[model samples]
Target: MQDCFQRTDWEVFDHQDLENHTSVVLDYIRFCTDNVTRDRCIRIYPNRKPWMTEEVQSLLTARNTGFRSGDKVLYSAAKANLKRGIREAKVAYRRKIEDPHQE
Candidate 1:
């Protein structure tokens, strides 16, 4: 288990690696925990308002797989994409609601 943890899974682990890593690890963990039917962990919704949104909530549910804020509790690479998607969605929704006529 320790070997698995210490293994060089990220041959090119970099800042972008961490940045792009968030959603990969997130989903992998989710897939694992889901298989076991356990709520392993939770996502950080610094401001609770966003998490309440249906879109946000769905992603947050994906975060339930298991992990700390900056750790891969499951698969690789999925974490980054997931976070980016969620962030963009939130910004888009906020803009759409704040000024429906602007866009």
Candidate 2:
């Protein structure tokens, strides 16, 4: 973007400046990337699988909570629910692939 370019400190070039300019630019970029603007300019998105719906995610979260709480009954139930959700997702994916008009 124009803002990105405008923020850069442009260096003046002299008669024998081409090679020096390349090295200086490379070093500056390395410095900025390593220590200055590392992840500040990055946008992180949640990793979502194609078959993972909200229902599946919620079930998985419940399972994790149950495990963390050390409740065998809740953990078992949530694990079963997660398995069922995955099975349903696989069936839905296959049905979609087979019949495209199922949605």
Candidate 3:
């Protein structure tokens, strides 16, 4: 991420010509592209939600695979399962919050 926003010294271009400007621009473009690729390769895991269990993640993966394989029925089923999981998780979370001593 730091590479994406790294600052470059522009003072070197003070005495440069159009060719130098073109080279600089191209280099900058390549730098940005490399940074983007690097960033994608480095997965930054977000703070996990209490409701996002392993089952939910598994279902999401299945859904993605189904969609990629162009299986509409499989994708629909996976999506429905994921939604149901989320809905149940939300309800359970709310219940836990409402009755702190229920556990």
TM-scores for all candidates: the values are 0.33, 0.52, 0.49
Please provide, for model 2 over 7-80, each residue's C-alpha lDDT reduced to its tens digit, 9 standing for 90 to 100: 77674423266888788777766755665342435343588666777889899999999999999999999999
Q: Which runs of model 1 end up more than 4 angstroms from their true locations? A: 1-47, 50-52, 66-78
Q: Which residue ranges in model 2 land beyond 4 Å of their true spot? A: 1-47
**In candidate 2, which residue pairs clash?**
none
Residue-wise C-alpha lDDT for candidate 1, range 1-103, written one tens digit per residue: 3343455366433446675677676665665556545343557577676425666566555565434444475423445546866788878878877885565
Would you list the C-alpha lDDT of every candidate in the order shown? 0.58, 0.77, 0.77
Clashing pairs in 3: none
Minimum summed lDDT over a 10-residue window in model 1 is located at: 68-77
Better of 1 and 3 by TM-score: 3
Residue-level lDDT for 46 in candidate 3 = 80
Taking all chains together, the TM-score of candidate 3 against the true structure is: 0.49
What's the C-alpha lDDT at position 59 in model 2? 94
Candidate 2 RMSD to the real structure = 12.0
Model 3 C-alpha lDDT per residue in residues 1-103, reported as the tens digit of each score: 3555557665655645888788887887787778665432434358877667677788889989989999899999999998998888878878987986577
The 10 consecutive residues of candidate 3 with the worst lDDT sum are 36-45
